[model samples]
Target: MKNTLLICLFVFAALSCKAQNIIPVEDFFDYQNEIPDGTYIKDINNVLNKFTGTWLGSYDNKNYEIVVEEVVYQSQIRTSLTYDQLHLRYKITDANGTILLNTLPLPDDNDYVAMGQYVNPSGAYQLDYAGYEYDCGQSGTLFIKTFNDNTQMKLYLYLGESPYNEDDCPNGFAEQEFPTNSQMLLTKQ
Candidate 1:
């Protein structure tokens, strides 16, 4: 009887603890009470303007450039391709005058914007090139140092896995034995 009673009490205690652990969605975020001063907002805008110009650089002997055509704060998501919930959008182009990529500013929902593909696996958000999908892995400490305001370089340190999937290379893709590294350099256009 005592054992049964103890079990019931334990279950009740566990249920109680679980109930206490749950947090209401409404209470998850605490809204800020005060608005920012005008000067502070202006300073932020100035800093943003610094990031709004064209940047140019090179990586792996391939020249690249990016033109920040538009900057939007608190941007709304009209569509997935055009000005979604991103802070900014920079029209990117390569040296050969080919449209290479698009740079979207960081999203409020995520901790980091897909910055030059240092930490994305599926390569869904990375700049795609012919025959090679660059910057598509979870990056380590060395990856962060490659990023700079003027010239951004991303290195996909391929340990051993094939960068191309079976669908990409169907002719029985050869297994990679050594670590391969690919670099992408972005400069403001």
Candidate 2:
């Protein structure tokens, strides 16, 4: 009797470990109910591959250099769900070649690094952006859309007015960091 019980318990444990459900990244939000624990929103189709790599662009005499990389993350707060996501880093410099803001060298887990949220219905990827100047409220959503066979891309940054007052700004009115509303063309390198 003891030997039979042990074998049954082992089989059940093995089955439970394989019970995780894998869903395509695009269809993740379509689920009706709250996603169960241990569900994976995977990029099984490699839809995010085209956006990975370095991209460069310029606007208003400032050069923008961005890097996008994909990563797999497991969420402890969201019931241990695992998913694929993108992380972005950027460097902006003035026409005179003066460095303005650079998050390129920061560690991957840095708060200032823009983290990809999801792919929009228009196929553009949206990222949550928060610059180091957040005290002055330099934060917003950034969208990236690829074109010309993924060789070229467009970046649109939509930002809101600062919630902080002048007194909160040690720099005395934070200069807008990125181009707002207008889409800037970027080339993949």
Q: What are the Cα lDDT values of the candidates?
A: 0.34, 0.83
Best by TM-score: 2
In model 2, which residue pairs have backbone atoms overlapping below 3 Å? none
lDDT of 2 by residue, 42-140 (tens): 898898888899999998889999999999877757866888888889999989888988999998678888888778778888888887777787888
Candidate 2 achieves a global lDDT of 0.83
* Model 2 lDDT at residue 140: 86
Q: Residue-wise lDDT of candidate 1 within 96-142, one digit each (tens)?
A: 66655444453433322222221223211222111123223322211
TM-score against native, each model: 0.29, 0.83
RMSD, one per candidate, in order:
15.9, 3.5
Question: What local lDDT score does residue 144 receive in model 1, on the 0 to 100 scale?
Answer: 19
In candidate 1, how many Å is residue 100 off?
6.8
